[model samples]
Target chain A: MSNDIQDLKQPLAKANAGLDSVHVFAPATVANVVCGFDVLGFAVNEPGDEVVMRRTNKPGISISKITGDNGRLPMDPAKNTVSVSVEHYLKSVGRLDVGVDIELHKKMPIGSGLGSSSASTVAGLYAIKTLLGDDSNPAKLLPFAMKGEELACGHGHADNVAPALFGGFVLIRSYEPLDVVRLPHPKDLWCAIVFPDVDVPTREARQIIRNKINMKDAVTQWGNIAGLVSGLFMQDIDLIGRSMQDVLVEPVRSMLIPDFYEMRKMAMDLGAVSFGISGSGPSVFAFTRDEQTARLITGKLKQHLNSIKIGANTYVSTINDAGPRVIG
Target chain B: MSNDIQDLKQPLAKANAGLDSVHVFAPATVANVVCGFDVLGFAVNEPGDEVVMRRTNKPGISISKITGDNGRLPMDPAKNTVSVSVEHYLKSVGRLDVGVDIELHKKMPIGSGLGSSSASTVAGLYAIKTLLGDDSNPAKLLPFAMKGEELACGHGHADNVAPALFGGFVLIRSYEPLDVVRLPHPKDLWCAIVFPDVDVPTREARQIIRNKINMKDAVTQWGNIAGLVSGLFMQDIDLIGRSMQDVLVEPVRSMLIPDFYEMRKMAMDLGAVSFGISGSGPSVFAFTRDEQTARLITGKLKQHLNSIKIGANTYVSTINDAGPRVIG
Candidate 1:
């Protein structure tokens, strides 16, 4: 509409023409890998987040344009998870004096339990690092993004943060500053996630569960979590199948998802190792050893949801190798 | 001594002979695996338990004789951990009509944190099962052994039972019946265990720790447990290293061990990826990738303990593929 606005568009075009600021694609992730409850995640290889960041003299992070968030994502850089992380990371490494403008293409659905929000935050921070010429490795970049994530999620839970920082299965090293560990992800594994047509706010769903767990139950939960992680790392299919059980969060949260019970039952009957509420709720994920089983599990879950007349979207993604990426 | 005592000595002519009735051996195990505390354990190939069982006209399970207990262990059949589990397992399965005579060879040191008591109970039950001639699978015998464990450890904990029953690295599936799931232990891994000469009674050690855990810490604990198990399953050395850290149990238990703070530092400095308190206390275990690292960690741990003049035994072992075996 104006000459200045049009000029802004020209810089964007030139930046897309293979500049130093390159495009990287980071995938959507699944957090709270079943038994892990609040501290495990895996970045998927497909259907991810794209960020476009360019160097600037503005002395602060700027979200030039926001798309794919239903236009509700904040353009004001200070309030954004991605911008805040980038700023914090830069400042911590004594480079906050520089600045960048990041254009976010938040392709994944918000609050979808597919780690849509975390993916964006991870991508944004990574894009800023590339734009600002920070060659810091993933381990170095983790804390900065985790701090930003605390702002977004309202709690410093690393179930999402660890995977978002480093692809594959992730372990929370420590919670204070969000130290993280990237566990080995399966080389030949794919995930089938079903996003039901529903909404269960993470905060609201989390509050519905009891604050205290019986010591007996707590010990069992920890043992199962250990078993689940061991199953993943050992590539022990039967062990993984059994370890996917979670007694702490799933029973309480599954009540929020319409027909969650029926879907879970049918999926297991159709050969899913296990099924549980994803993140807060309204989404559920299952593990399969091969593509056929994955597809079969997905179909079984969908049929149950459909019989109850609930709409949902299913995704087939391999374990995520790249967490956050950039695009023009 | 008497003519009957002389007869008993002459008949056991075969050095490792298994009696026609039953001969049971339960492998020594490392429980807790650091962050898992009361809920994780794995059987090792070394330091096993040996029990010989024979059919008797007695109305109930009876402990006829005990060797290597240093005159300290209980003689009452119903009160002992091993005998109790066998009785409970048999009673629960509706075979209360049967009777047995158990001879426990307490080869492993009592209160060693190598699950000597559990090994005793498991070995006793195994010997009884062998005598029964029903050829029972592991699932059938779990209840009997678990009940026996409850008698000794106060609360029936699985960090020991699961590994002894199934062998190798194991995850406790549930506590009710003490259900268990065996995990795939990595081929290249080795554990260097340091058994401090000092004693930390399991009962007293458990009491010193806090009974309640905050939800935040609980989440982190479970997260790390899952990560550690995943690391073992995937054979992801990095994840295993990262997940081996503890926030719940170690922080408190470490205070009880003298110079534990410094010992851990020395172990880590010796290239061990992770070091943690074994079971209740005193014994410490370090995880490494290769034999060379294992030796290094063992040497370092011994040296540190000695520097503080804390006498201890150090051992390096791979994950034992073989669990309980026949004595013949």
Candidate 2:
């Protein structure tokens, strides 16, 4: 649908045309939730990414600024997940001619295994959708967000992006058909997250995991997965804690994070419901039932890391139920 | 708490001692439900076993008669699972001196992969518990029933015995702690079961399965497991049907069952919700939303087997909610 110059200008000249700009915030997410490997994830309230978008008369999308990345994120529009995803979305909706300038603010740490890129990409996609007045169901935007994930990581897994986009816990039951099922969780569930200043590359972290696992271990893992889903539906917190065990990836991936077991023991002893690596490595999370315990866990965990001469950042919040939203 | 001989006689002579005899019927079960191998199972209403137990003056348990087994079952009390489980129960409760004679009536086919042994063993346990006037929680008898499973098969897996004892759908989340969680299912759900007259030894079926599996397949299996559990909780019938897929066991075990894929296709075409090999199979089952569909499925499946000159027994029933009951 090629539009003449006069026709393209007519819509923007109207009194109530689409907004001139949009600002959106998308929350960070914890992927590979314990027993759920590549299948499950949940969103949190704090430590999110921010995106600012402005419509222009110019032809294509471009990255105006990238902050908090410490020169790590790519500046090229084709190389960055945010612009690439926005381009995919624009092309899908036949709005490629509509120009936009994107600014990604990485409020969360990059490569900390806390879905940092997913948050930014989701924020950018949401901003563009709002700018173009596409009010279709947010789920329709999932594939475009997934393209961003594929660009950031080699594999286009939705465990992180689904929750970051949909809010709450989401299960990617099948990737070929892109079946994402939203799961119920306890209302009072709290998460205490900590990112220790230890470098663990996502590519290398994924490479260390075994390609094959014992059948007995697979049975145990699936049983725990069943129990975890059952616990969420039944709202049984204790069962959820008991079922959050991982036999396949954690054993090998934990080696990448320093003092992982020690931190886990400390968290468990302090009455955390369950503790494990958030995403791949470095970042760890503790599930708790109350805000007081969540804050207490983060406090003690930060102290332990400091005692070991390691710097860390911590956050405590309940599960996020609303995904990306407009701020201005 | 040693009872003197004269004291035991005094109690027997009292007006209200223990019952002279009791008879119980325990329902058959389908273990390794699709994606949930070694973890999930559900009980059926028909094709179960009956057991009759009588008090005797002799101070030891004995099997007086074994019927319907085609001269295959053992008569020795120590060798039979029914009597062995009874002996364990008696010892655990300090009732070793109590005497009982057992009669095993195999109402269902043996070695049919439909939990035939589990039914008889559970029936015998229930009968003994009733005759001795021990009206405790039925779950306390699981370990003793598991002993019966160990006698029947080399492994002490609880997938078969758990549903037979607990009734409905059961999940054995952990084996070491013996954690069993009962799950809810739709009230209108029905099962169409077919037992083909073929031999697939449980030991050989187990041996054919690979000791190790690809991690990617494990993830897919667990994703389906989680989805199935969630569907059960949410009472979503369509989701349940979609998630009832097994990637690990079905691919290998299906080779042992004749016309497995054809039967599955026929069932699905007939509007059955899901179809899979029951237990290790030779026996297979189809889940349906209504009794009419279930009956239709079984009728068609039986005719197909007959056309192929293969003998089969077909049944249609809803899930059994009661584990075991005294007949007289």
Candidate 3:
């Protein structure tokens, strides 16, 4: 893999000579989509992370500053997801001799169950690639981003990172060969997301899942997965909504979120096309056809969360087609 | 369901006033297409069954003739799958008193694991509908056809019957609501099918499957399912072939088919896109992009089976798009 990246750098390096600094904004993502647990995800527009990179004459990598994480995130270059992935990217391109300084900015909450770490890592990687003038396919940078995910979370799952890096909806068809598939969706599709301020550790949530499940449920889940993919291709909103039903994960994980079922009922009544917990939850999402409906759902959900004496944040945006963009 | 069918009969009754008899042909189908397990299926061009329906003065459905089944199929209206399903259809349409004489010709081998019974049942249903001038959607008759599948295999699965009735590829996304979704495929897709003359009972094949499976395997299977659906939607033949892997059923069921692995290796070596057991066992299939590759595969597979002292029938044709066509 490193050899492949080095080979690509030879042709593009001359084109990237004059760049000294770069800044990027990588959007937050929702993983474990309904009926698509661990296999599907999509990107949203708000609550992301930003990273600024500067080339230096020094020999290695370092973190110049950190902000927006409430001092909870690591500042060490070896430990932080942002600097760690950048180091790997530099190594792959045979640029370890070239020093780079990274400034980490966590625009989203840590452990919000909305791929906070993934955003930071993808932003850092995107910034480094831009600074080095490597304009290869963005998907080529997925492995470096996944290395950061493995550090943030124990598993190196790609559902969150793939969408955050490539934009749009993606299906990680297989992990062995790292087969990621970008799916088609309606242009008018919008998302209403609510992140309730609650403590639900990713490790605990994962342990609660059953190691084995009935074959009958597996068939139902795969059937729904097939339906969901079909719905995306056909651009049928109604089919996508109906096929979002998830038999596994939600039943056990919903208990961790206060009034998850009640929120789903309210969202459905308010014309949300589909409702499900985003990532591992405390953060939940609903898909809608129009921007008005999306805003309405987020507003109502935010109010409900406040009434329950829980702090929350809400966002309404269409699916993000451009993943990370240069903001500087 | 009965009320729904009866309500649809009022306006189309006059259009069928003069028809006295109808002959229809329903194509054979391959269910459990690789990773699809019980939800995916497609129709083939050849090796189908023919049914001839005649309006008579009698008060109920009666089987007048049975041929090509080698005296194995039942003649009783209540016992035969063709007449039992036809009886159910007539009753559902509030025409239980209508008289119909049916003649079933089993053009394909019985117990070939290639949906022999589904073709006969779908053909009979189509013939009855055409003879009575009920010009409704062919999918409306799926439930009655499923009844025939129940009698034949003891499970009312629509994988075979749906494709035979609706044509092309289909996904039975849900069973409770009986949701069936038609999918798109590459026009050049061709299938090479082989039915080795061996007895692998459907009951035994089903019984061998573990009721409980590891969650990891389930995840892998669903990922492949999503990939396969995406491949079909995108018309990516390579993706479709890559995603047609069956980790759940093929591992255990392949033990039943003699030299299954060897055959798969040979087929792959011959440039067949994908290879797997079709439906259950005793019958296997390979997909290719062109007719020459398909014919070559079937010819080589037939020769291999003959060398092993196993009688086999081979077919090479593109996907059957016009299912259950009227012959007379």
Candidate number of the best lDDT: 3
Please give the ranking of all candidate structures by lDDT, highest first, separated by commas.
3, 2, 1
Q: Model 3 clash pairs?
A: none
> Candidate 2 residues B42-139, lDDT tens each?
99998899999999997899999999999899999989999999998777776788899999999888888889989998998888777877655777
**lDDT tens digits, residue span A100-187, model 3:** 8989898877878899999999999899888888878888789899999999898899999999998999999999977899998899
Per-prediction TM-score, please?
A: 0.74, 0.94, 0.98
The DockQ figures for the candidates are 0.43, 0.76, 0.94
Candidate 1, position A96, lDDT: 58
True contacts kept of each: 0.66, 0.84, 0.92
Best by TM-score: 3
What docking class should model 2 receive? medium
Using DockQ as the yardstick, the better of models 1 and 3 is: 3
- lDDT string, candidate 1, B111-133, tens digits: 77888888888887777656554
Q: Could you give the candidate ranking by DockQ, starting with the highest?
A: 3, 2, 1
